[model samples]
Target: MLKKELPLKHIKINYDPIIDTPLEIIAQYPDLYEQKIAENGIDTIIYDNDISDNVSFYNITYALNKDCMMFMNLPLEVARFSISNMTDYIIQLLEKSYYVQFLCDPYWVSNYVSYQKEHHEHPMLIYGFDTVNKYFLAQDYFDYKQKTKQLVSFKDIDASYYNSSFSQLPDEYQLLNACVLHCSKIVNTKAKEINCDLIKQSLINFLNCYSYTKVETEGIYYGIQFFDILINRYHNDSDYVSL
Candidate 1:
């Protein structure tokens, strides 16, 4: 079932970047990524740093989807699919030049943490699968020490999927779907360019329309007004911020 690996590599790193799994996948599409930034006037793609100054989280997925791709969910019976069927499904994706993103329990994929003793859902990108060698070529942006890609055994992945605990929310499944990315379809299509003036106006309109309760008990606020309050509290009160 093994075929070919997409000749893709990490083009850049948004230091201490936002840990959004979807954004991590979007990062691989460098040209489209640049277009998004250019259109939106995103000075920093990294999210953790400038929370107050930017709108990185605003309509990001919509923008990406509008650009050049779609993630179609895959169906598999976690309790009944034979290993051969599962592997064949993955190999077919590789053969068609598509990347598979699997949401699995992190416990089986890593040995560094005691996550194996517990269940936690995580998304991993699959770039290549080898039937003869018995491993899947995977890459993770969540690792702090290293950003390069690595290989994971197919057996461990299979075990994790079968053993995952479905969440209370029916929409929030444990083994979630094996979504395949049709990046090949977007090879010639360019992401729509951002109109900086429009973005500015949108931000202005959002701020004008923003409203929220300030009661500390309510625990929520929105817009620049809230940001001012937060900054003031951080400077004036020791208990206002927490590590």
Candidate 2:
């Protein structure tokens, strides 16, 4: 008798009801909710036998827009094991591909860096370099978190305030401003599918206000070059025809 080989099993994911309860509260604020989904997709894969049995995986799939990237959110008990396994798989995939930029919230980097410093055996830390400038620029938010004991709130929380303060920053801060512009551009384009001249104008207004800062001149030049490269690549690539 010939024994047939079984198909490879798909990994199961579970969500934490307690932790995820806050998501419902956050959803009340439509703008905030949309921003959260944009920054961290609603579809988060979990791994728990108990929850997995009750919930329909379809809901998870639906929460995460079909176009967005998927990420596995491991529980604390299995975080290390799951992260190691996932990291290995990611590295293998990256080896086969060209470029892979892990676009994640800065807090993830902080946690991973701190974990590596403590244990001294982090695989991701293999590309460690001085992040002093990045840290220096982010010190205020980090300090606020340390004191208030709250996760860094997204910029949308006080859009006007940030918009004003952002206008005052030096050109060196243009990179950060560009990230915000990019996000705004994505949101406007996705929501309306029309020319976003208004959004672009707003970005330019914000950029213009910081003319006194030396960082502004250099930052604008760099930002334009970076934007052009990104636009050209995305436009030329048949697979990535749209932003």
Model 2 residue 165 CA deviation (Å) reads 26
Q: Write the per-residue lDDT of candidate 2 for residues 135-238, one digit (tens) a residue.
A: 10111122323311122222311221122232333554322221111000001122222122432343344334333222333223332233243334433441
What stretches of model 2 exceed 4 Å from their correct place?
1-199, 215-226, 236-243
Judging by lDDT against the true structure, name the best candidate: 1
Candidate 1 per-residue C-alpha lDDT over 151-232 given as tens digits, one digit per residue, 9 for 90 to 100? 7777777766555444521353322222213111112123233233443454356435533233343433333443344334
> How well does each candidate superpose onto the true structure, as a TM-score?
0.45, 0.21
Candidate 2, pairs of clashing residues: 13-46, 14-46, 14-47, 171-215, 171-216, 172-215
How much does each candidate deviate from the true structure in C-alpha RMSD?
Answer: 13.2, 19.2
lDDT of 1: 0.41
- Report the Cα lDDT for residue 154, model 1: 75
Q: Would you list the C-alpha lDDT of every candidate in the order shown? A: 0.41, 0.24
